[model samples]
Target: MPIYTVNDQSIHVWEEGASDKQVALLIHGWSSSWFAMSPLFPILSRYRCLAVDLPGYGQSPKGDDPVSIVAYTDLLADLLRQVTDQPAVLIGHSMGGMISLTMSLRHPELIERMVLICPTISGRLSMFINMFLGPLVVLERVPFADRVTSLIETRIWRITDRVMKPASYAERSAISSEAHERIKADVRRPGQGQIRAECYRAMRENDLRGQLQKISHPSLYLWGMEDNTVPLRDASSVVAELPDADLRIIPNAGHWPHFEALVTTQRYVRAFLSTPIKLLKAQF
Candidate 1:
């Protein structure tokens, strides 16, 4: 693991695989670090794999400005420019999926294909349904609201720390305590709490369904049939909006099919990636 400094932000990155293989960038979800995508590293090691901890999570440093989907995607573009000159595949989970969606739509030339795992489409239900989440949308909209919301956000994170670990794994028999701890421990650290507050606020406020229509790349949507965090109805709706998207529901898996049903998810990813997407090479 190494830290890459770009645009006054320190981003912690994990890279593996050969330089000759296709460049694949991995993005994790909200309140999570790059470790969430660690399961895919080994399986996809045949390709050039790059996983990053966005500012405020894992070992990455946070920026002073309020985090938004655009900021994260801009940082992703910066990292890609530094690593690869060719168009690469973008793989994102949860909040990362939202960022990836905006990135591909905003800068279509930079990305050739995509893999979104149980991504958030429209936040209307996710935010309104949760009592605490509804408040966040208001807090994000009001001036100087972060000052008060920051305290509430920190406390909520502390309270939900333990809950997220188990909530991520729906199939109890397939749980890996080691993997769970490795993926979650750093996120619950003392100072890491408030950084994700802005990201969550932005996620709650944005409706991504309209933006999905702009994406023209081949995309693979892998949803855990048992995912409670992002509902199947929403996932199906997401599939409907994308121009070229394939849906694959993993049975007996939860929000984290990559972790709970590792082999099956890997097989699915490999098949999707191998489907010969017309790589959009850089124009010289």
Candidate 2:
């Protein structure tokens, strides 16, 4: 319920646990708010955990135009400066990962470490396809573009509903029924649609493959083998590019592995964070 006014935007933020020694910032993916990373709450709370609804999503107020991922990086940096004095570990999922990567490149001092979950780096061929066919895909934002994409997303969600059923059992088991309901309720916020549209637009225009080399922070890249959204094949390419990076794949998990494999994901994350880099390097 806490809100911080940053750069004329009202960002809804929440914190769990009270710790001056460590802090972790949770950044959600496209179409998701702070709740998307709720699966990590229990484990992350052991440290100082800060989850924020990016501008135009959840309780955060909407902006005039959908801002670019770089813009988000700037916003997050400013927010960090304003809120906590502690350097924070940035945990970003999907688009949030993109923001985190940008942050590392632009504001490495703000982060102690990074955890990227199914992060998007390159502007894949799919994005090109969307670029050429996008105008025809949607009709709202741009003539014939928004409508087309809206229709495509609607159908994609329909298919996702079917394909996602297998993982539902795990997702349901990971969180209580009540918590699941809360997640669904949060997704239904009025700003969600606009936020989704703006995000899609920003993604279409932003490509950061050229900038990955600039990031020097130690990073953990987590992937879900079953993720149809961002294929697992991209993981190796990302790892190869990052200077200090490690990879982990979650089995029987989709894009939302934190939800489907919450316990396993949290365990690995904590273990990774606790392990001394020198010791880990010695073992290798």
Candidate 3:
């Protein structure tokens, strides 16, 4: 693990696999750190994988600027330049996916290709989703809300652990106990409430739908069939806007497809990243 500075921000970075291999930069979603992308690390042995804890999440401390998509894209752009000389493959999840899309539009040279997992496009969505996220955003403004939320979620997960356990070992590994604890700790971190609230607001205000047609890189969009957070229906329409992209739906999975269906996720990601560009585009 190493720390890289972007202006006043200090980004915590973890790298795995061989240096000689093609670079694969993993970007975690909102309220998540590097661990959110860790499950895919094992399958990326052929690549020089790099994951970062964005400011205001994980080990990285919040910078002076409020957490926003544009700020993140700028940080990542500078980070990629510092970490590698070549354009690396961008693997972004959720908010990270939004950042990747923005980067692809703004700094295409920094990204050789893209793999967006349940990415956010327009801030709009179904009423059901609004009901789900609205309260969380409001709760962030309350004092000690994080502790209460964590306690409740911890209990809920504990109660359902056995019933919710995946049948396969590979899927189980994706959401191991260690990963759960780390994610819980991230939720309870100081200033996290403000960060979360700010990010939610920023995402709601920012829209990238109009810009999708400008993205030139080959892109792979992975969406969970049952994702309530950013439903496939809300994002699937944008696939047509992308000049070169493919959408793969993961069955029986939620927002976290990598956790719910590790093997399937790996299959699509590996094939997309390894296949020849011309051949991949031909299939679409």
Candidate 4:
């Protein structure tokens, strides 16, 4: 619930564990808050864990306008600089991964290492859709368009909630009844909708294929084989571009692998961090 002013944006940040140890920043996906990363918090708490609710999500204030992924990356870099002097390990999921990758490529000095989960990168068809169809979709903000877009978003949210509910880990399941209700309450807080809209706008404009080669930090790419949101096919393309990247596929898991398989996800993440970069590369 605490807030910080980074790049003139009021960002919501939560910190746990000792500040003297290595830091890990966990960034959540689109339409998600820090709660999405709750599954790994207990284990990750041994080290410094910082989870952020990006601008326009959770308790953060809305930005002046919609953001680009690169802009979000800059915001994150600025946040890191303001929050801690130590280089932090960046763990990002979905759109969060895009921001992490952008940060790694643009401000490598701030990052010690990275763990990207089902990252969003370029897809030939998605590129065409965003470049062409996206504008048309945004047009829905107009007179009748707003209503239509709202309807569509509502339907999608319902479906996604159903899918995610079952995939939540046991620890989460114990509190499932109240967990989602809490998330909904947080989303309903003032300025959340606008923030989410801006993040979606940013994700649509982000295309990082050209900058992938600039990333020099050691990285781990984790994918859920059954992830329908960011398909496993994208993993090959991501690993191929980064010279120092390793991939791990979690079977029977969906888009939120850490939630679906919390124990496994935590175990791997800790193990990878403890080992040398060379050993991590051999883990895949």
State each model's CA lDDT, in order: 0.75, 0.70, 0.76, 0.70
Candidate 1, 195-270: lDDT as tens digits:
6556656776766876676677778889888776677777867757753467899987877899888888999988
lDDT of 2 by residue, 72-144 (tens): 8898899888867766789988888888988988888888788888887763423333554334323334635
Better of 1 and 4 by lDDT: 1
TM-score of each: 0.84, 0.80, 0.83, 0.79
Number of the top-ranking candidate, with lDDT as the measure? 3
Q: What C-alpha lDDT, on a 0 to 100 scale, does residue 114 get in candidate 4?
A: 90
Task: Tell me the tens digit of each residue's lDDT in model 4 across 158-240.
Answer: 64355444432222332344656765555344334444555556665776666677777778788876666666657767767
- Of candidates 4 and 2, the better by TM-score: 2
Residue 136's lDDT within candidate 1 is 51
Query: Taking the tens digit of each residue's C-alpha lDDT, what string does model 3 give over 12-35?
Result: 988897777778889987767898
C-alpha displacement of 14 in model 2, angstroms?
Answer: 1.9
Candidate 2 accuracy as lDDT: 0.70
Reference-based TM-score, model 4: 0.79
Off by over 4 Å in 3: 139-182, 281-284
The regions of model 2 sitting more than 4 angstroms off are 123-137, 140-188, 277-284
Q: Residue 91 deviation, candidate 4, in Å?
A: 0.8
For candidate 2, the per-residue lDDT at 259 reads: 74
Best by TM-score: 1
Shift of residue 60 alpha carbon in model 1, Å: 0.7
Q: By summed lDDT, which 10 consecutive residues of candidate 4 come out lowest? A: 166-175
